[model samples]
Target: MNGALLTTWRLWDKIYYRCTRLCYVDQQNNNIFRVVIKKYGGKPLRSEQEVVVSPGDYYVKLHIHNCQLAHRLAGMTGEMRLGLAALKEVKTSLPALAKFVAEHPNADKITGVVGTTILYRGAQPLGFFVRDIDSPLVRWYKTFFFKLILSLCHPEGVARIYQKSDKLVAKRVFMSKRDLLERYLDDQPQT
Candidate 1:
């Protein structure tokens, strides 16, 4: 039963990778605009908008929004499932991003989430999170000495850990963003 579950998980991971690739390709050809509303109800607002937003930022916003909706729809179930989904999405997208970074030597920098946000030293962002600070994956990634040793022993375990980590981050971010937005809306005095 465990074997069957593992196999199903693996297949889902592959499908996720394919979907991410397609999304990346589509995003490459698309132009995204970030519009900031400076004024609401004829009053000048403090927020400033950027004409272009990075894919990483866009992904973060999408993830946060999804998390909020999922929470609303499934309540606890949404929280559980969405976290898993976010982790899977991030894991599947990372390799392609790494490859893109390698090929684009002159790109600015890539941003990814680790314990905090990590800059990829190029124009691509690799958003990831480690499940446990003491997990082998985190240790291996930080130390870089036991790459071969760790890879040989536990690839799936590492992936799962990172996935769980990302899910936690997503949940936190979703809650915080939702709370802030709610507060902002609440503070607006109705005329």
Candidate 2:
């Protein structure tokens, strides 16, 4: 999070956000996720709730703002503390995401939300269904990209990745529309 690094991150974030049209679920710089509505391209997936997401279905893809996350988590010590903080940030964003989907023009067409992450161990508890990436190429690409981001953002840097490589494999997480609404939305209508 040094001046130069921050500048690079800002530039990258700007480019990525524009190219992907990722909409912020909360305050621009402070939010943990940037999302885009996309058609599911991979094999069909079924959540624990028996919600089946098929190819060509429209869904929201959650993109973690890693640099922003790193900046927030910088200098935080201990795995437990970092994990808890990250989890808390995700929990906070759920309501906003629920609102976004509920208010979207294609709200009825959207089936659910999807995201890929290496940090998926705690996802099921949060109501996400974790699934292995079907394509080996995609799996490799995601793993490399996630680890690179981790190395760049983590306090321990490359050392942490080297030590924990095995546990860092990437996984896709799904939360169906029904699950998302049931978990994060209140009876009050979304504005």
Candidate 3:
């Protein structure tokens, strides 16, 4: 409960002022320069002054940000998978988890995945979305495409404001999880 409250507060803070500063070595001038990247309402400021990072600096900052995002996403996905795995023993487990995975077979789906990862034994992991993934060509396509999307979202990546749809989807997922827990915990088995 307390943790959730704190996360909410921190998220509010992060979104309200999603600013990132990157320090780069200006090769020509041999001087260190700072680039301020601000994402307002999940949109990067387009004005010249707003985006000062050079091509090299842009990559540097983007790479760093992307690395951070990947690490965080992996940690979260693993934790969610393990945590939900643990909950399997609970007789009243979440069923939506299985469906959610079916709809989104990739890690990003689960990581963007703000909802929950429930346990399931009666179903499979990779849904139709990634069932045949046998040939190298197909596999490469899937991997690279997901990575590209992740990169685009990296600079903003929840650090900035969320769109209305994003917020609603997240809320729906959370409510479903909450309802599942409540129903299972409180519902009396039909006698």
Which candidate wins on lDDT? 2
Candidate 2 lDDT over 70-129, as tens digits, reads 878877888889989988878777877887889989999999899999989888888899
lDDT of all predictions:
0.29, 0.84, 0.28
Candidates' TM-scores? 0.24, 0.92, 0.19
Instruction: Report the CA-based lDDT of candidate 1 relative to the real structure.
Output: 0.29
lDDT agreement of model 3 with the native: 0.28
How many clashing pairs does model 3 include? Answer: 1
Segments of candidate 3 deviating more than 4 angstroms? 1-94, 98-132, 156-191
TM-score of 3: 0.19
Question: How far out, in Å, is residue 71 in model 2?
Answer: 1.5
Report the CA-based lDDT of candidate 2 relative to the real structure.
0.84
Better of 2 and 3 by lDDT: 2
Model 2 residue runs over 4 Å out of place are 187-191
Best by the TM-score measure = 2
User: Which wins on TM-score, candidate 1 or candidate 2?
Assistant: 2
lDDT tens string, model 1, 17-69? Answer: 46652223113422121111111121111113321222333122222112212
Error of 3 at 181 (Å): 15
